[model samples]
Target: MRIIISPAKKMRVDTDTLAWHDLPCMIDRAEVLYDKLASMSYDELKRLWKCNDAIAALNVERLHNSDLRIRLTPAILSYEGIQYQYMAPGVFTDEQLIYVQEHLRILSGLYGVVRPFDGVTPYRLEMQAKLPIEGAKDLYGFWGSAIADQLYQETDCIINLASKEYSVCVSRHQKPGTRFITCVFGEEKDGKVVEKGTLCKMARGEMVRYLAEANAKSPEAMKDFACLNYVFSPAHSDESTYVFLQKKSQDSEE
Candidate 1:
């Protein structure tokens, strides 16, 4: 089984510290996107990135100066989001790292799908970015079935931990006989499921860590995940969706 997750916008380049691995499988395709962004004027890029001056300037410099093939960090270590911060791949053991390398994939706007150990240079492009390619209206259109095809090649089953923006690419193009499962993390509140953004991120990260540590290799194995006070809610889950619910503080008190 493979677990898919979204790439984080908050990133850094740290080639000096980490050992570089092979470039992403679709690096040639990524080069096209990179060139398109590199060719845009500062104001146009700022608009495309939907960021302020500081971020725009830093990314522009990175695009102009960085060599994608020369220096890179592991894709798993590249992101610095709330989820990644909590998952903390940096501290994983060798066996855990191997398990993650084999089973975890990050869905990227720039790189399509990346393995945890894939070498990547930092740049900004979201899966939902509106930048139009020649024949495609948006990044999703350009990516099309390419990412899904790659995932299908890797594993027969996919445990989706990514947000919709990134997961859509895979969910839309599954070949017949493929198993796709989505994991939902939320809390019970007022007799409803409440998915707070930050807690969800933390739970997703923790869940990934749990799976890696346990070397979970099947859908049934993942059901055993009970990280950060979450418990698998069988009544709330189905074949396609697995829901893990945290008890509300008031409920915990009671």
Candidate 2:
């Protein structure tokens, strides 16, 4: 099974902790995107990035000076979002790290898809950003079915730990007979599963850690995941989605 997750917006360069095993598979495509972004003026790029002057300037500088091939951090270590922070790959055992390297795939706006150990540089493009490239209207159109196609080449089953923005790129273009299971971490409120953004990110990250440590190999294996107070709710889950509800604490229940 392949675990698909989203890339973090916040990133850093950490070349000392772990050596990247290889460059991203889509480096050529990333270079194409890099060239496109490089060609845009500061004002255009700032608008495209939808950030404040400070963030835009930082990213513009990153684009200008960064090389995709050099001084790269492992894709797993580069991201600094809550999800990655909670996953905490830096503390993982060697075997756990190997499990993740084999199973995890990160979806990116600039790079299409990357493995855990794939070398990557920091960049600011998001999948939903409106950058029309080579006649494609947006990143989704630009990526088309390529991402899903590559995932299929690896396995027939996919465990989606990514948010909708990145997961949609895979879900929308799934091939025939693929078992795409989405794990939903939320709470039952007013007869509905309500997903809190920050909590969900934490759960998603923890879930990846759980899977890696367990060396999970099947969809049924995922139902056993019980990290960060999330318990699988079979009543709410269906064939395509596995729902996990956060159990109320003793203090909260009082």
Best by TM-score: 2
- Write down the lDDT of every candidate, Cα atoms only: 0.89, 0.94
lDDT at position 13, candidate 1: 73
What residue pairs clash in candidate 2, if any at all?
none
What's each prediction's TM-score?
A: 0.96, 0.98
TM-score result, candidate 2? 0.98
Per-residue CA lDDT of model 1 for 6-55, tens digit only, reads 88988887766557568889999999999898889999999999999999
In candidate 2, stretches whose alpha carbon ends up further than 4 angstroms from where it belongs are none
The digit string of per-residue lDDT tens for model 2 on 1-254 reads 99999999999999999999999888899899999999999999999999999999999999999999998999999999999999999999999999999999999999998999999999999999999999999999989998999899999999999999999999998889989999999999999999999999999999998888888888788889888899999999999999999999999989
